[model samples]
Target: MQEFKEREKQEQTISSPLSESLYENLRRIRTVFQTSHDVVIRELRIGEDKNIPIVIVYTDGLASSQSVSGFILDALLVHTPKVEGVHNPEKLFELMSTSILAGGEVKPLSDFEKLYLAVLAGETVVLLDGCAKALMVSTRGWKDRGVQEPTVQTVIRGPREAFSESLRTNTALVRRRVKDENLHCEQQAIGRITKTDIAVMYIEGIANEKIVKELFERLERIDTDGILESGYIEEFIQDSYLTPFPLTYNTERPDVVAGGLLEGRVAILVDGTPFALLVPVLFGQFFQSAEDYYQRSMIATAIRLLRYVCFFIALLAPSLYIAATTFHQEMLPTQLLISLASQREGIPFPAFVEALIMELTFEILREAGIRMPRPMGQAISIVGALVVGQAAVEAGFVSAAMVIVVSITAISTFVFPSYEMAIPIRVLRFLMMLLAASFGLFGITMGLLGMVLHLCSLRSFGAPYMAPFSPIRLAGQKDMIFRLPHWSLRKRPAMISKENPVRDATPAPAPPRPEGEQS
Candidate 1:
C-alpha cells in the first residue's frame, strides 16, 4: 500500500518552500497554480549589466496592470541603475529592494504561505535567482463599486455615502466619520481557500476588552474552507445558532457602524460585501436609526415610540385575530366583531387556516417582489396588492378582515429600522400564529414569555442580548426607547464600556434663563 501511494499523484501541500534555484521555485509555483490561466509570471534580467534573473508573479486581473508597468516593471528593467560590482544573489535581493524598487509599498517575505497570501490578496511578488526571500509589492487595484447612496438602511437626513465591497474602503468610511485616534482596526485573513479579509474595529479605550478578546478567539476558531460574505463569518461567530433573534446587527451604512463603535460596540467588516456586522446588539437597537441623531430630539423620540408600537403590531396582529375569532370573541368590540363576521360570512376557512394562508401568500409575494428584476419587482408588488387585497376577497377565497390583518402585519414589519431584526420577527410571526391557533390567547401569552426568556438567556459577545430591559440597567436606559439630547447623555453603556464609563462631562445643559436682575 505504501508503494502504491508513492505511485499515485499527491496534492501540493501549503508548506511547500521556495528554493535557491530560480527554475525550481518557478516550477513549484506553476505546479500549484496549474489550471489557473490568470496567474502571470513575468521574468526579466536586471542590475549591473542586466545579468540578474528575477521573476514577478501576480494575478492578471487582480493586480493593477498600470502600476506594475509604471512603478515596478519600468523601475526594474528600463530605469535600473548599474551597480559598480556584482555580489551574491542574496545581496542582490537586498540591493534591488532597497535601491532599485520604486513601488509605494514593499515588504520582504521568507515564508511561502505568506508570500502566496500576499499575491492572492492582489499584490506582486518578486523572486531572485539565488534567494529564498521574496519582495511583496502592493499593486491592488480592481474594479469595485464606488461609494454610493446606501440601498439598504438609507437615511433621509444623514450623509448619503455608503460602504463599498472593498474592505479598505469600508474601513475608511468609518474612519472618516469617527476621526478619532483611539479607533483601531485589527485584521485577520479567514478561510482556507478564499482567504477572505476580516477587520475588527472598536474604540481602543471604550470597547470592552473582554469582548474584543473573545471576538478574536472566536474568529480564530472558525475552520471553514471558504467565507464568501459577512454573513458567513456572522453565522460562525454568533452567540446562538438555534435562536431566531439575530445576535449581531449588520448594516451597509458606515455612519451607523461608526455610531455603534462610539457606543462601545465592535464592528466586524468582511471582504467582498458592503454590510458590516456589529456585536453586542441590543433588542432596542433595531428600532433605532442613524437619522435619529440628525433630527431634533423630540421628533426622534416620537418616531422611536411609533416603531416600538409597530413592532408589537406586526408580531401579534395576526395571532391576536386568530385567538379572538377562534376562542375569545368577547375581547373585541361588538361592532368590530359584527363587521368581521359579516366579511367572513361566505369564507369556509377557519380563522387559523385563513391567517396561515394569507400570511404565507404575502411572504411568497414579498420574496417574488425582491427576487425579480427591478422593473418587474415593482410589477410584482402591484399584482400582489391587487391579488391579495381585492381579488382574493372577491373570489371568496379569504375574508376581507383576514386580508386587512395580513396587510397591516406586512406594513408594520417595514417599520423596523433594521432588516436583520425583521428577519427573526418574520419567522417568529408564523410560529406565534400557530401557537395562538392551538391554544388561543393563553398560547400567545406563553409564546411571548418563551421569547423573552430566550432573549434574556442570550448574549452577544459576552454581553446581554436584551440589555437595559431584562437586567434593568438604568444607566443604559438614557437612549433606550427614547432619544435624550446628546449633551444630556452623560455616560457610555455600563455593560460594554466598562473601562471609561463617562461619555460627557458634568454640568448638564439647561434652558437659558431670560436676562434678569440677580441677587
Candidate 2:
C-alpha cells in the first residue's frame, strides 16, 4: 500500500517545465514518446561548407505535409548554404530570417512559449545545433468543413454562408459583414487540459464595457479539464445553471453575429466549433430572425405573432385536451364530448396515462429521426407516426383524438426559430401536462402563472428576460409583438441601450411638389 501510494503521488506531481534548456526539453519529450510513429524530427544541414545541423519537428496530420515538403524543407535544404563553425543563435536567426517566405519568421529556440504556440498553430519549428533559436514556418493547412448554410437556422432570403470550425475563418466571416473599425476581437485560451481557443467579439463604442469585463472575468474563472463545444462554455458562464431558459443565444451566421454586435451585444466564438454564442440575449431576441427585418414590416409582424401563438399551442394543446376530457367535460360541446367519451371508453388507461404514453413515444421517435441518416430520416418519421398513431389507436391503446392532438402539438414546436429557446418549452409542456392531468384547467392556469412569474424574475447579464412587456415600457412596444416601420423604430432595445437610447436621426418629411400636374 505504501509503495502504491508513493507511485500515485509521483504520477500526480508530474509537471512540464516552462523554462528549461531547449535541447534538454526536446530530449525529455523524445524519451517520453519513444517508438511513437507520428512524431517526426527532420535534421537539416545548413551552410554548405559548415554543415550546421538544424532539426525541423512537427506532427503528421496537425501540420501541412505538402507545404512543409514543398516550401519549408526545400527552402532550408536547397536554398540555405552550409555555414562553417557558426553557433550564434542570433546570427542563425538573422540568416534564416531573410531565407524563409514572407509569412514565416525565425526566433530564438529558447523562447519555448512561442515555439509551442507555433506548433499548436500547425507550423513546423526548425532548431539549429549550438544555437538557442528556432525558425517557425507558416505551413498551417488542415482539412476543414466547407462553408455551407447552417442546418439549424435556415432562412428563405438571407446570406447563406455560415461559420466554420476554424476560429480564424469564423472571425473573417464576421469581419466581412461589419467593416467598422470599432469592432474588437479579444482572444483567450481556456480549458485546463484542452486549451481550446475562445474569441470574444464586440463593438467597442456600442457594447457596454462593464458587461464585457464581467464576461471576461467569468470565463477566466472556469477551471474545467476540456471544452469540446460552445455549449460547455455557455453553461460555465451562465448566471443561472438550474434555469431551463437559455441566457445566451447561439448562431452560425456571420450576419446574425454582426447584427448582435451592432446592438451592443458580445459574441463568443469557440475553436473547433461553428456555433458562436451571443451574450445579453433576451427571450424576444430568439423569436426575431435576421430575415424579419429584411421583409415588409406588416408581414414580419404577422409572422412573429403567428410564431408566438404556435409556441403556446405547441406547449399546451395536448395537455389542454387531456384536461378537458378528464375533468372539464362541461367546457366542450355536448356532442363532441359524447363522441370523445365513446372513443375513449375501450381504452384501458386514463386520459393522463394515455397522453403520457403517446408523448413519450413521440419524443423517442423525434430523437430517432434526428439521429438517423438524412435519406432515412423522413421514412423513419413517417413509419413511426403510422405505427404510434393509427396502429396503436386501432389496437385500443389510445383514442384517435389523442393522436391528432399530440401530432399537432409536436408540429407546432418546430415553428420556433431558435432551438435553445424551444428546449424550455418542451420541458414546460411535460410539466403543464402533469398539472392538467391532476386538476384540469385550474392546474394549467397555476402552471402558467408560475411560468410567467419565473420569467419575470429571470435576467440575462443583469438585464430583465421579459423586457418591454413586463416592465411596461410602452415606448418600446412598437417592436415587441409587432414590428413598426423602420423609420418609426428610431431607438434600439431599451434593455441593451440604457445609456445610448437614440438609434438614428428623425425622418424628414418629403418636399412639397410646387408645380406638379397631379396633387
Candidate 3:
C-alpha cells in the first residue's frame, strides 16, 4: 500500500508539470498575433514594499478604455495600497467585486479559455506570477454607428429610428418596442476567423419553437471564415442556394424585426451590420411593410392592390407586347393593332428583338443610375428616359407601343417594397418575354403556372411559402391580399398561429352611444 501511494504521488507530480507547460504554451501562442491595439499588457506594483507585480492583458479594441482607465487602472495602480496576500487571483476577484471602483467581476486567468473570451468581450486580464489563476477585469469600449433613419425603407408615418451596426444596440431597439419579458434573445459567435456575434431574437410564447430551432441549427452549421456583412450570413443559411429569389427576408428597421417577432418569427441580428434577417418568411410577407400597418386600412389595401397590379405589369408588359404583335395580332383591337403596326412599319428588327434591345438598354441605364453618385443619378434617369424612349422611337429602332410597355413595366417593378423580391421578377420578365415570343399567350400561361408551382413547393421553415393562397387558409385571407381593419382581424395567421392561436383576448365592442341617441 505504501509503494502504491508513492507511485500515485509521482504520477500527479509528473502531470502537474505538463499542465503548467500547457498553460504557458497557450499564453505564448496568444501573443503571436502581434496585434498592436490588441494584446495589451499592463504591469502594476500594488504597494511600495510588497514587491508583488501584476500584469494586465487585454485586446484594446474589444474592451472599454475609459472603464479600464477610470476604474481598473485607477483602483489597482493609485487607489488601493498593495498588500502581499492581495496578489492571489481569488483575492483579486473578491476585491474587485467589493470595490465600487471596479464596477464588474474579476475572474481567474488560469481559466485561460475564459480569458480569451473576456478579451473578445473587451475585458482586460491581469496575470500574477506564482499564482494559479489570472485576474480578468471588465473594460470593453468600442465605437459604433449611431441609430439613424433607415435610408432604404423610408416611411411617411412611422418610427424614424433604424437599427445600427451593433447587435446589442439593435436588440435593444427591438426590446424597446416589445416590453414583454417573454421576448428572448440568444447570442452566438459565428465566423471562424472574424468571430462575429450573431443574435437570434423572438418572443418565447409566441414564436414557433420548431422553426426557431431549425434556424439555429442551420446557423450553427455555417462554417465560414468571416462574416463581414449580413448578406454573407444570409446567403449561407438560405434554404434554396440556387434560387434567384431570396429565401430569407432582411430589413434595416427595428419595427419590422419586432413585428416579425410578434408574428411568431425569429429575427437574426448580426454584429457590424445594420440589416437584420427574419426567418420563415412567406412570399406575401415581402409585400407587407411597417407602413402598411401604420396607414389607414383602406389606403393600405389600395396600395397593396396597386402593388399586385404593378407586379403583373412588370412581369408581363413586355412579354404581352411581343406576343400581341408577333403571334397574337388577331386578339388585339383593330384600331390599337393598326396603330402599333404603323409604329413598327420602319423598324428593322422583329418584335422580340426590339423588345430585348429596349429592355437591355433600360436595365443598363437603371444600373448606371444606381451606381452613380447621388447628384448624377437624377440626371442619368432623366436623360435615359428622354434619350431611350424618344430617340429609339424616332430612329425606328423600337415601336412607340413597345417603348410605352417597357417603361410601364420598369416603373411597376419599383413598387415592390423589398428589393430582393423585385429581383426575381426582373429575371422572370426576360424569360416570359422569350416564351411569349415563341408560343404567344399559351407560353405566358405555362410560365405563370410553373412559377406558381415552384412557389407552392417552397417551404420557409416548413410553412408553405404560398400560404392562405395555395393551401387556401380562409382564416388568413383577411390579411393576404389586402389590409383588414385591426378589430376585424380576429385570428392570427394560421401558419404561425399553431404556436400562438390567441392574438387578442376578445373582440373589442363598439363604443356605447349617448343616452339621447337613437338608432
True lDDT of residue 430, candidate 1: 90
Q: Give the candidate number with the greatest lDDT.
A: 1
Top TM-score hit: 1
Each model's C-alpha lDDT? 0.87, 0.81, 0.80
CA displacement after TM-score superposition, residue 361 of candidate 3 (Å): 1.3
State the lDDT of candidate 1 residue by residue for 167-192, as single tens digits. 99999999988998999999999998
Each candidate structure's TM-score, on Cα atoms with residue i matched to residue i, is 0.95, 0.90, 0.90
lDDT of 3 at 423: 91
* Alpha-carbon runs more than 4 Å astray in model 3: 1-30, 35-39, 48-50, 85-89, 97-101, 104-114, 509-511, 517-519
Model 2, 1-519: lDDT tens digits are: 999997665344334332324466466446544676776777656676635666777777778898888777777777765545546756766777675433444444445555665676677877765555566777777889868888888899888999999988999999998998988999988876578899999988688888898999999899989899999999998888868999999998899999888778899999999999998988888888888888889999999999999899988997899899889889999999999989998899998899899989998888888899977987898898988699989999999999998998988888888988888888898899999999999999999999999989888887788888778788778887898888888877778755466667779457878895597
**In candidate 2, residue 134 scores what lDDT?**
64
Q: Summarize candidate 3's per-residue lDDT along 7-60 as a digit string, tens digits.
A: 666444423421233246345535544555556766565655747566666777
Better of 1 and 2 by lDDT: 1
| TM-score, predicted candidate 1 vs. hidden true structure | 0.95
How does model 3 fare in lDDT? Answer: 0.80
